[model samples]
Target: MLETRIKTRSDLKGLLMDAQDLFRDATTATGSKADELRNRGLNLLDAAIEKAQDAQSAAVSTSKEFAQSAGEYVRENPWKAVAIVTSAALLASLLARRRD
Candidate 1:
């Protein structure tokens, strides 16, 4: 689902870029054709903004769910959580020392 959202956002971004280019090109035209291109560009821009907002909402929801699940796990296994953190810290310190 996340991958799909990412792809969708990428597609929308590409489309938005295309729309902007079209709009810029429209500036070189005269009268009705220019108006049409500008209108089309605005429509595409609006759609891209809407989809971007939707992706952001989904990401926030997914993060909240993961955070909630992690909280539950830590509550259920406090000692194990502490052990994991300690081990991770030790590993990080060792890796950092190696870089020096």
Candidate 2:
């Protein structure tokens, strides 16, 4: 899943770079060539936006699943969850203080 997200981000980055190049080309182009370059750039940007939306949707779904599982665990073992959270909070605060 992480690898997929990373790859998606990488792909999006490349698409954005290509779109930028197209737009730059359009700026220096004339007549039909300029219009074609602009259109291609717009299409690339649209594709990148769609891919980003898909990745975001997947991340939100995964986060909701994790939250649901965590909630179930906490309900099943209330005291254990409290202890774990307390320990984590204490450790985080201690580490933060040390950093300060």
Candidate 3:
């Protein structure tokens, strides 16, 4: 009877060791998956930042071209440009006052 009890206890210890090893393997797998997800998120954010920078550069270039064209037009037609600008300013002030 004593021998049988000792065998049973040893079996239980072996089973416990197997369960611990399985748990450790699962934990390692989960940690690796989490790290992969974190890296993917960072990559997506970097791509978005690069896209935004490109868009900002394009907008600045377009604005500069528009300013140059408007300046040339005003130089060519000074009176007409002055009248258009005054009317626009008056309309804008009226709209601002109404909003306030």
Q: TM-score per candidate, in order? A: 0.91, 0.92, 0.59
lDDT of 3 by residue, 6-72 (tens): 6545655554555555555555666777566555555545554565565567667878999999999
Candidate 1 is scored at a TM of 0.91
| Candidate 1 lDDT, 1-100, residue by residue in tens | 8687879878797978989898898989889999989988988888888888888898899999999999999999999999999999999999999999
lDDT of 2 by residue, 21-93 (tens): 9999999999999999999999999999999999999999999999999999999999999999999999999
Best TM-score goes to which candidate? 2
How much is 87 displaced in model 3, in angstroms? 1.9
Winner of 1 and 2 under TM-score? 2
- The local lDDT score (0 to 100) that residue 91 gets in candidate 2 is 99
Residue 57 lDDT (model 3): 78
Off by over 4 Å in 2: none
Clashes of each: 0, 0, 0
Cα deviation of 37, candidate 3, in Å: 0.6
State the displacement of the C-alpha of residue 34, model 2, in Å, after optimal TM-score superposition.
1.2
- lDDT minimum window of 10 residues, candidate 2: 2-11
Q: In angstroms, give how far residue 4 of model 3 lies from its true place.
A: 80
Scored against the true structure, residue 15 in model 3 reaches a CA lDDT of: 49
